[model samples]
Target: MSADTDMEALMDMTRDQLHAAATRYYKKRGPTEPDVALIEYGAARAVFKDYGRAPGWFNRLIAPVLLWREASALAALDDLAGVPRLYRRVDARGLLIEHCPATAWPQARAGDIAYQRLDALVTAMHERGVAHGDLRGGGNILVDDQDRPYLVDFVSRIRRGRPWNLPWNWIFGQLAAADRSALAKLRVRHARHLATADDYERHRPSTGFARFARSVGQRIRRGVRFFGARS
Candidate 1:
């Protein structure tokens, strides 16, 4: 079948049908713990992410929540440019998202326009009360064929509300700041002439809590992935 026909057929399928097809045909991509896969539906390619059986106590406890969090974040993003369109939630543990045909931010010295686009995208996300908490990771920021920036992996996103309230607000604020700082650093490195004074100002050092959170997150990811590999 043609790609378009394939995609339409896949989309037309019932949830159970889609799930079965994905199980049978999806090709595993990234690390196994989260079990990311490149799935070909009717005519389209999608990313299937399953965080159900993560290794380690901390990971197992949090994996389902993170999976839902990411799905919620993507739903909020909806049709915004630079944000992938979420297809469906395969189960409690999995989501199928639009496959971005893009490369990491490090692939090119993306000009000022790309940085501006990224800033605008980030602003839109914040306006909707979502913060991309882990923008420092190169893999999460993608540059498309036209050089527009697309952010992926919303598992670490900070949503607006209680739990995200009070002292948590302080941490969330730092995370938001870090996102801006990361963009600023990118502009400085790839498009120096376009770097604004504000960008430079926002690029200050990460707070202690931000540092600690990042460290803990890294350790968890490493531990879970290592356990997964061993298994």
Candidate 2:
């Protein structure tokens, strides 16, 4: 990490200033995802997700759609705890997001409270009509110094449908279950002791139909992700 971009230097700068000042990046190796940067200005910091830098048509057309989708999810979840705050849209191609000060879950050592909190957070998120379709991947969870859990990367989220929409509502149910199963998967990986007999029984291998639903859910997720990335 380089020195923080100073406040004085940023005073007269536009939206692009902080992006230009970003000193570190993550996942620059990936071709499919957006460019993520850690932008700092004095003590203020943020994560910038910019698809403007993506290559080819994905940059011009697909990126903004994906950016808007994620931004909408953030807005829907704006008041929810344990999720990053949306600062503002940088442009059609990017977003400025609040920085969660935490270690990635895969690297961070956390107590059972973290898992518990994560479960609650996921539940709260669902109650607000969002299902995070990709938590099983683990890269999107974070644990901070005080053991609170944080969820990031809302690009693949699915919203609950209106009551009159049966099919969409059913899809939402399956995705919501997937979210719960994802939390169970987390326990299996990072805190197996936390999984009780009931947890094992309830979340045991998904039934054939459940498996089908999960597959459908993931397909929808990938469809959304790619559509946004490819837009």
Candidate 3:
């Protein structure tokens, strides 16, 4: 079967074929984590996060849980523009995702419209009940040649609560605000000349939950996963 050269190409190749043909990789922390690999076929480009390559014990005990988290987030944010598409799930240990063709936020030379578009994208993501929880760091964002924004890396996302879940819903609000605050800070960083008073206000110190999330959420998550694996 021949898939089109567009996003359909992302689903054409099987997992093993893509893995063997991966041209490059990013963020492969340890034997305990997954390998973020780039797979490029004729007209298809994608990223495969393969926890299958992690140690047997780690892969069996913990990888599935993290993989599930990312997959869940991607599923929840499906069809959202800034978020990447989830191509396919490769067993319980890995998943395929769209390879965003854009420059990293830190390195991007974007203008006010790009920043405005980024803010709207974040707002749309929040409306879908997911908080990035890490956009403040800037590594997760990307900008295309047209200066459009893209948010990547769903591993750190925090999901919102149901209607009856008041406490957790409130927490989601704080974390979502953190995402906005992060964006405002980024706008000032990349194009300060266009930064407005509202941007400065939103960039102020975040709520406690948001603050903890932005500051040490990854460390705490890693620690939890490590300890959970031991138990």
Leading candidate by lDDT: 3
lDDT of each: 0.71, 0.77, 0.80
Residues 47-154, model 3: lDDT tens digits: 899888676576787788878888999999998987898889978988998888887888888877988899889999999989887777688899999988899877
Worst 10 residues of 3 by lDDT: 1-10
TM-score (all chains, Cα) for each model: 0.76, 0.85, 0.86
Per-residue alpha-carbon lDDT of model 2 for 43-88, expressed as tens digits?
6677888776667665676667768878999999999878998887
> Which of the two candidates, 2 or 3, achieves a greater TM-score against the reference?
3
Instruction: Please rank every candidate by TM-score, starting with the best.
Output: 3, 2, 1
Model 2 ranges with Cα > 4 A deviation: 1-16, 29-31, 201-209, 215-231
lDDT of 1: 0.71
lDDT of 1 by residue, 35-72 (tens): 66666665677777766444455345556776788899
